[model samples]
Target: MRLFDKEKGLFISGPEKQISCASQIWMILAGVTDRETGINIIEALDHCPDAEGMSSPYMYHHRIQALIDLGLKDRAYREMHEYWGGMVNRGTDTFWELYNPQNPDESPYGGIVIHSFCHAWSCTPAYFLRKYYY
Candidate 1:
């Protein structure tokens, strides 16, 4: 699908054509097609560089939700545990606004100190786990 750019190895939104994981997640959530197609789209994400990878908990939350909707419960729970648990392993008392284990010190504002350590968006794992996994 043109929604995804195989050359760029990422999913792009219409018009602006901006590549973001959110687009893929939303399309899957909307039931774009079969589960295999959804799985392929997500697999394509692995080809993208870490800079283009999911940088926010907001996107992660949606991605996890999509996985659950696709009947990928085991993967969803595994990813939830890995992503969120990684932060916990790092000594995070609360979820951070942005997290990239590959580059833990990455910051959009040029400094890590400005990043939000306790963000509302990052707190939705509780709801997802309760409503779906638990």
Candidate 2:
């Protein structure tokens, strides 16, 4: 309850004071939130037009897995298309540690060049493709 922001309709990192898909993912993974509430959280997040969103592919990877666990395959696919495919559409041969379609210069580390442009954290697609798609 302390972590969930009722006003925003998602879980958050208290100190950061931002709605966190990561927190919702961890809550679902750790069984802190029940199945129904997990679904509600996901739905609420979808409707939360102003939520900042997962900062990078690293955080988004867990979000994909969490969506899979919750049986939201279509939602997971759409999220992948939106995040990872956003990079693909840009002709990036490799996935990035940080990315923002609206602003390529955006970076949590203060500069775009400071992070991994081709990161290992983005390699889990094969796992999902094999286990879930195949």
lDDT of each: 0.81, 0.79
Clashing pairs in 2: none
Global lDDT of model 2:
0.79
Report the alpha-carbon TM-score of model 2 versus the true structure: 0.82
Q: What are the models' TM-scores?
A: 0.82, 0.82
- What is the per-residue lDDT of model 2 for residues 14-133, given as tens digits with 9 covering 90 to 100? 587777566677888788777788888888877876666666787788888888888888888787778888888888889898877667668888788788989988876757777888
> Please, what are the lDDT tens digits per residue for candidate 1 over residues 1-134?
76667676556875977766777777888887578878887777656554246778888899898888788889989998889898999998899999987788888899889999999999867998789867
Clashes of each: 0, 0
Candidate 2 residue runs with Cα over 4 Å from true position: 5-8, 12-18, 49-52
Collision count of model 2: 0
- Residue 82 lDDT in model 2? 83
